[model samples]
Target: MSLFEGLSAFPITPADPSGRVDTVALARVLNRLADARVDSIGLLGSTGAYAFLTREERRRAVEAAMATVGGRIPVIVGVGALRTDDAQALARDARAAGANGLLLAPVSYTPLRDEEVYAHFAAVAESGELPLAIYNNPGTTRFTFSRELIGRLSEVANIAAVKMPLPADGDFAGELDAIRSVTSPSFRIGYSGDWDCAASLLAGGDAWYSVAAGLLPVETLALARAAQSGDVAQTQRLNAAFEPLWSLFREFGSFRVVYVIAELLGLCKVEPLRPVLPLPDTARDRVAAALIVLRKHFA
Candidate 1:
């Protein structure tokens, strides 16, 4: 089966009130998701506050997750860094630590041209034995890989899949169709930043990498299954129910609110990392209200 075939929960790295990674709390979150039957777990991705973590912290977080998951399901570690060598090294470390695959988010600095990005992936592929998935989140990287670039990278021996963050606006349907048409037939496309879960599936995403699913796995899995089964009504019902929580991302800039709400929901205990400040009192109140509404539907 393809690595991207089913629901994968992107668990936020739980941190203590002082902002140190709370390994015990993180293990609990992973155990709960495993119990919910999520197909896989992705560690240290954007939802996990990867950018804020020191290299050692990232390694420790993966170790904690692996201990909890313990071969029950595959783990895909996000390997993104300012330097190509660092990214490759992280990929190797993740593989050595028992990760089944690596998710490479494009390097942010220097804003590489398409060919350069491909070369970077090529280098990482050559360095690691594990399969690799390209994580394309233009909003974060400021450099979105073109379909042509993805097509080229898909040809790389170890490049297994592409994770495209569905654009918040513009012609997403057209964008998806364009991507589907251009990418290699073997390349799986998993939606990353999208929250319109049902609509994204209807539009033909093979799978979803969701932070919300970490908190409400059963509901998220049900929504994905319903959509996949072609039950439009049930899918819409679930999607509509999630609209309030989804709006949190729209109104407030970052996904920090969702992370905080996850904590409020008892899914994870991670606090927001540096520079990505905690939600303001007003935003916290808003998130609290949204969580109340979300629990009514998802719970």
Candidate 2:
């Protein structure tokens, strides 16, 4: 199976306001996912606030992840930057730090053409010397990838998988078929939106690049396994337990809500980086209530 297969838990890079990473707190969070035995750990992902951290801080985050859970689980570090050279450098840094795989997003201040994006990925894949997943995050990057572009990138050496956004038409099967027809069969396809990933799995998607799994790996893994097994009823039940949290994620963004989740669960106490404010008191109350629902179901 591809290293990207199954539930890849994405954890926050617990850092203080100065953007300095707290390796101890980070290791504690990673230990939870490692102990839960999640399929992989996606460090420095969007949920990890990769875009907000400098390359130095990003390298520190990857080093901490590998030290904590590197041998226990595959670690896919995000190496996205506004410039291709910078992304390539980040990829190299991740490889040197012992990351097992790489995730790259086309983060451009100006809009990037498809060819530019493809070349950027090719350069990183060549330099990184590790399996890389295309981070197809149009929501943040503002660049939607055409199916043809994905097809071309799949053939690139070391570009092994693609972390897709939820299909807008809500047709996982149709979307999967469209992308698969163009790409090689071994090129893994995965989805990121936490609420819709079970359906994506049930529809034969290769993986779930999950945010919630970062903190709730045990519960999230149960849901992913149920969907992978084609147990529709059990999948629905497990997903229901996460519905409240999903709603909160959609409302406040998982990036913001997860910091609160870590604190609420007593894993860590931290805030989102500046320009991305912490959730309000009312929203924190909602997040707490959402956790209650999940606890009741999983307990």
Candidate 3:
């Protein structure tokens, strides 16, 4: 299987109240994910709060994750920055730090054109030899990818996989089919925005870039395994069980909900980075209740 072709854990960067990336907390989270037997760990993905931290903090987080992983599994570090040069620099650093792969998003305050976006990944691909995954998260970056553009990008030599967010239109089964028709077979497909993972995977997509995997890897991996095994009946049953958590993701965003679940589970002291508050107590109570059902019946 491709390195990211299974459940790759995306953890929130655990920082202290002072906003410093707490290496100890990060190590604990990494080891937990490793023990869960994730195929890989993606550090500094948006879930990891890469945008909120300084470049130095990101480097430190990646370093900590690499040390903690100890080559037991592949580590893909995000090299996304608003500026192309900065992104290239981060990619170089990732290569130097011995990361096995790179993940980047078209993070921009201003809108980016097709050529500019292509250039961003191409420049970084030239900077280092590690494999790269293009992350297309329109909700967070306000940048979207047309299938045509993604096809063109897959031509870049080192670009390996694409991490896609399921569309708001809620037809990801169709979306995966559409994406596959445009991109080549060599360019693997992975979905993020975890709610629709079962549908995407059953539609023959390659992998899931999972938020829940870091916090609830065993539960999430069970669903992924069902999808991979072509057990449609089991996959649907598992998907039905997760609809409650999916509802919470739609209502209050996965970033908040997952951290609350992690905190309640005693996984880590997870709080969103600055400018975002913790989920309200009522929301947490709802998530706690859903998790109870999940653990008792589904998980």
Candidate 4:
């Protein structure tokens, strides 16, 4: 399968007020996304609060999402950790739990050479036994995979795709050309931090890993379909309808804004995770207002 061919929302792992996994809330979110016809559900991703979750919590989240989804769509589990062994263990657990694929990021707390990153991915690919998508979120890992490293990892067995978060000011075409140059013909390139879905699509992005889609899946899926069909007018219209929501990412963090919007849309019950802090009360009100406007426009 292609790396990220369809709509995938990174659902926040529901936590109770006491900070425990809230499976009931998680099930509700998954069912909502499935009802909206999202192609896949990504658990334990950056938005899912993976770093705060223990290994058991991660496993439980995967199981809960899989059970809730029940083969309706694929589940791509995020298996990122500060240690390679921990990440590998999570990958194995996710596979055993029946996840469709794995999203593996480089280990944090370590400055890895390009060769070391390749070797780490090589080991995880061997152990996971599932198709792997190399996650290149430099903001979190403090390391970005060079094109050379991507080329090496792409050659590894089971390494099927890449998730690249391009620098904001970087030359996207140049970066795309460099990645395309080294990756195999079958390797899919996913734009991880794409807020402007239409612009990214027009700029040659194959697919996007979207957080806004988590709140507005119907609109998000419509935009994705329009992009795939090369309907520029429709794509532009959809993007314009949701442009306010997309613009929030610039003023505030994406995950924080997404969580607030989720609660506003009644998709999730909890607030944003700690350390990240909840959106200001005024911001929450603005997001709610924007979402209401979007619902009407998209309707």
Candidate 5:
């Protein structure tokens, strides 16, 4: 529960042009977030380009993150894969790497059914003793898990929590209410669409699985803490300060903007994998301007 109780950062795995995981850059990013004291760090999540990494590269990325975080914070390694066997293999590797927990989405090429989704997680659950968090991202996976399905999955012993994307049209509170009414009491839930994070926290969601925190961990932490502590004024102020950046995320994909933002801030030099382009130059310029203003505002 502690892993999903606060700000959990999902950072991109920095890679060189060779598509190899850049251990040095990866270390710097992980160490920075660890120093900032995020509740947890997720290795090989969507933001980390999990699907793009080879099995070997994914293993090394988990190792690099664990090495840098060094038990300073819990590491939740993403073990999602298109096939159940690959997912189990990654889960085995994560357990070997001493990862604290696992995150999984029902990755699919063709669509998957409710029972098949349950089986996918059940298969991986048998692979290791590490706890599991279901990542329900329908947009990318093209497979959605309804509340009923989530409830059924929560019945599995190690399936501890779920990371749901923010509900659209400002219905975060309503969505939380509806989901909680159906799910088990022991199952924790949180938001992942970073734009609605403050609202999610204020609405009593369990965590913020943040992409922005990849580069600005401390700043994002401040926002989560303010909302979590019921500091309405502070939360509102920080949310407004981030509004422009959030707007950019809502326009250009957050996946794209994060790549540009990291390069813009000199945190790392990395690019999105093929089929996912980096931000266009014009969008990058606007993001650059927003980052400058945000830095000064945060300063």
Candidate 6:
């Protein structure tokens, strides 16, 4: 499989409230995903709290993940920064730490023009010198990539894939077709929204860049497999099992919910970085209830 294809589990970078990465806990999380045989590990992605972490800490997380995964699975480190140069430095750090690939989001303090975003991506891709997936997560980055820009970036060296949000119009096939029409045959396209990812896979998406898979790899992989095989009935059944969790993910955001999951699973005991509060008691109770529903199917 391509580095970007299949189920790419994006795990939380377990850390203390002060933002110091707990390499041991982080490795435990990666080991769980690796044991589940997720196709790839998306280290330092949004769920990993890459933005809140310092560059040194991000490097530590990548080194820890690469060590734990240890060539068994591809590790794609997220290298996003407000400044292009900082992002390039991060890409180089990831390469030095033996990351198999890179994921870059167009993060900015000021809104960026298309040309500027292109330049930022090109510079980071060149610096990383590894397969790079464009993270088109406008919800967090607040910058969307137009189809024309995606086509243009597909031509950039090392820019081999993209991680897109769920299409707004709910037409995964049409959106996939439109993007495939613009990019080369080898340039892969994937989606990150957990709720509708099975449909994306059924509609021919190359990957599921999944936050849910980070914590529920076994269950998520089953759904991915069902969808990828065009087993509509099976996919719907599995997706239904995940409905409660997906509802929690949408309500509280996967970033917060996954931390709660890690604690519930005994994988780690930590909170998200400050300013991103842990789910309040009421929402956390909902997450617990959601997990109970999932366990009925996967346990």
Per-residue lDDT of model 3, residues 1-299, tens digit only: 78768888898888876679988888888888889888888888888888888878888888888888868879999889999889888998888878999999999989999899999889988896789999999988888988999888888889888998876787767877787788777778888877788777877878889988878878888999999888999988887777788899889888888788878878777689868899988988999988887888652
Candidate 5, 172-232: lDDT as tens digits: 7888888888777777889888877888899889989999988789889999999999888
| Segments in model 5 whose C-alpha atoms lie over 4 Å from true places | none
Instruction: Estimate TM-scores for all models.
Output: 0.92, 0.99, 0.94, 0.94, 0.96, 0.99
What is the model-wide C-alpha lDDT for candidate 5?
Answer: 0.87
lDDT of each: 0.79, 0.94, 0.85, 0.79, 0.87, 0.93
Q: How many Å off is the CA of 33 in candidate 5?
A: 0.2
Report the lDDT tens digits of candidate 4 across residue range 1-299. Answer: 36366667777788865457888888887887889988777778888888888898889888888888868878888998887788889999999999989998886675888877777888888889998888898888888888888888989998888878855675666777789899888887777664555555666766677776665778888887787677889888877877777777768878888778767767666876566788889988878877877888877
So what's the TM-score on candidate 5?
Answer: 0.96
Q: Write the per-residue lDDT of candidate 2 for residues 122-209, one digit (tens) a residue.
A: 9999999999999999999999989999999999999999999999999999999999999988999999999999999999999999
Q: In model 4, which regions exceed 4 Å deviation?
A: 1-3, 167-173
Better of 3 and 4 by TM-score: 3
Candidate 5, residue 162: CA error in Å? 0.6
The TM-score of predicted model 2 comes to: 0.99
Structure candidate 2, residue pairs in collision: none
- Cα miss at 92, model 6 (Å)? 0.6
lDDT of 4: 0.79
Comparing 1 and 2 by lDDT, which wins? 2
| Clash count in backbone of candidate 3 | 0
Which lDDT value does model 5 have at 75?
Answer: 94
| Candidate 1 residue-wise lDDT at 232 | 89
* TM value for model 6: 0.99
Candidate 1 wrong stretches, greater than 4 Å: 16-19, 167-177, 267-270
